[model samples]
Target: MTRYWVRAFLSGLALSAATAMLTVTASADKLFGAMEKAYVTNPTLNAARAGQRATDELVPQALSGWRPTISVFGEVSRTRSSKEGVPIITPDGPDVDSVAINNATSGNVSIQLSQPLFRGFGTVNQTKSAEARVDAGKQNLLATEQQVLFDVVQAYMDVYAGRQYVVLRRQDVSALEAQVKAARDRFAVGEITRTDVAQAQARLAESQSFLVNAQTDLARAVASYVQMVGQEPGKLSYPKVVSIPNSLKMALDVAGEINPQLLAQAFVEVARNSDISVAFSNLLPSADLVASAAGSDPDFAQSKDRSSAVQVGAQLTIPLYEAGAVYSQVRQAKQLASQSRIQVIEVARAVRQAVASSWNAYVGLAQIIKNTRTQVSAAQLALNGVQQEYQAGTRTTLDVLDAQRDLVQAQVLQVTAERNRVVSGYQLLAAIGHLTAVEVGLKVPIYDPDANYKRVRNKWIGTDVKTVE
Candidate 1:
């Protein structure tokens, strides 16, 4: 009965392991799926979209300068009075004294309308500046999206490589454990010395320590994966390589034209130039057409005491002197425009540097991965040979241990090189402004930054705002 129970227990363990393997194979997470989740749910990216919507409101605010404003005013008041010892003289009678008391209620109401006729072209320049700013905000949103996706890629690769390392370390510990057992068994028969058994035990202890550290590293990587992708990581499959630019020059050219950061700064420079015009317009003349209708009742008891008036007029304002404030503002705007222009050049240079660095790292890792794979294969063959030689009594116990350690090292290097290569490929795509939802073929609804802008650009009334999910 005991022997039968032992066989049943062994079978159950095998079944459980097979089940776990099947589950992992069935639910392996792909890179694009994680990216899609991050694109839709990432807090940072959503905040950026909200900011762009706020920037879009600037356009309608600027356009308000060309619209008419209407206002209504009203008031009501009660008055009471008492008089004593008043003298009155008639045309053909003597003077007389009289006392009088009176009480009255009065009310007034007015409506005024003013429409801007001309604002020294400030309205036009302000509108242009606002639109340019909106464009810049759109580019900024794109940059944020790229960054979030790249982060997801990095976290995914780290977790994948980390899992591999943990598995390798665990295997090393198991192998060392078996070697320690075998060395003791050999020593019991006097085939190996006590020193050989001690060496095997020491190696096993060292490998167990390494396995603990590898597990800790994997836990950290899993935490980062959750933060980036907004969910706990499952079995992650290896990601395929993304497309990259053909040459360094081509990458630089592409980044110069479409890299979101550089384009955003270029738009900022345009907005700054428009700002100069807006500031200079403050020194020019402005005109407005004004109209008003007013009515008032002097006494509530008298029907004929009500009076009404209507007026229409044009107002003009010319800034002859303003204590040099407007001139100072114009100079300040010019300086800001110069600063923005310089910023555009600075951003372009930075984008070019990122592209070049990512490209080189990606290329270098590819070669390293190839070499490490060869090294792993060679080390595995050497370990196998050494173990056989030790069994045949031609090699020392230390020879087999050294060979096993070298194999593990080579395998770990290969895993790290592959992980870095995948990450650098995505990094290169991001640098060239291609690592976006639409560009990466994510099966998610691409966020249209222009949608909210269009909805609010020409809005004339109402305070309702659309909510984002």
Candidate 2:
């Protein structure tokens, strides 16, 4: 009896060791590797960065108002006409006669320059609006980066958890197969009924079905992993749960301060207010300095008859009325600005709700993890007792099967709970705006949205558009 107890203890220990081996906790490096790959290679992230670069172009467009525009234009044309009572004097005297001229060629060339001195502060406000929008774009890009990183975390956890589930189901099936063999042996010796054998077989079949489903889930997870991480998933280790704020209030505070969506919306309000200024600017006068130098030739011949002139002057235009267009635009801009302010409030409320929800999920998963672990331990102990009692003819085969089923269910719960706990932590981190490549310290080159912005922000003359990778 003592030997039997010792053997059971060793068997339980071995089973625990095997289960622990199956639970592959992915290293920090592996988690970071997936995030880094997604950061540099994910098409969604790359597209967002490209969009931010496009937003940078607005700055240069706004600055164009402060710069001089220079242009050169030329025209050559032929004239044909009949002249009446016209006389041409050639080194002698003038005569009056009926003259005809045909196909007279003339050419003119001019270079003009204009520099805007003022546009009723329209250019100033426009530049301010564009700058604000660029800031918003950067924040939006950061938000996208967080989303992509969160997705990668989820995919990694799913694949890892799915594979572990398949392993657990396989173990359950194998155990049930052994139980069926034992039941058959007992029946052959007139110790048990055929119904006992059938029960074990039924449970085995159910376990096999579960294993198949787990495999399918794993395959789907792999496909998603490939899409998000831009490559095939390898043996992923289970991720450690991310650390988050201790309470809901702390989480909300962090989110309000750093959440990219909220920040982006605030910048949008600034941009809209600048737009209102730009619209009202139309009611004021604009001033510009215009200069031009030109040469005109009456004939195609190179002679002293060519006339050239240079002119420079300032121009001021005061708008009297625009059919109510300017007034309507100003009103529209004010309304939109008001709407943007309201949107900022809406966004803040939404972010607060999100942070609260994420905090609840994180805390809930922690409790679930604890309860599932306890359930696994208790179920394992109960299954061991039931198996021993059945061997001693003190428990029915059905009771033994029930205990085993309970153990299997507990194991599945534990595995799923662990996965959910990690995912919830990652989500909480994202909700607080910390799920970024740089925040996670991924081992890859961080994309700089400002690099491309600075490159093309003041470009004077170029068609090649620079974009962030």
Best by lDDT: 1
lDDT on C-alpha atoms for all candidate structures = 0.91, 0.88
Per residue, candidate 2 scores C-alpha lDDT tens digits across 369-459 of 8999899999999999999999999988889899999998999998888888888888888888989877777778888888888998889
| Residue 388 displacement (Å), model 1 | 2.5
**Clash tally for model 2:** 3
Per-model TM-score on C-alpha atoms: 0.88, 0.85
Best by TM-score: 1
| Tens-digit lDDT string for candidate 1 (126-228) | 9999999999999999999999999999899989999999999999999999999989988999988999999999899999999999999988987787677
Supply candidate 2's per-residue lDDT for 47: 95
* Candidate 1 wrong stretches, greater than 4 Å: 1-25, 84-101, 186-199
Which pairs of residues clash in candidate 1, taking residues 3 or more apart in a chain or in different chains? Answer: none
> What shift in Å separates residue 443 of candidate 1 from its native position after superposition?
1.8
Model 2 stretches astray by more than 4 angstroms: 1-29, 79-103, 187-195
How does candidate 2 fare on TM-score? 0.85
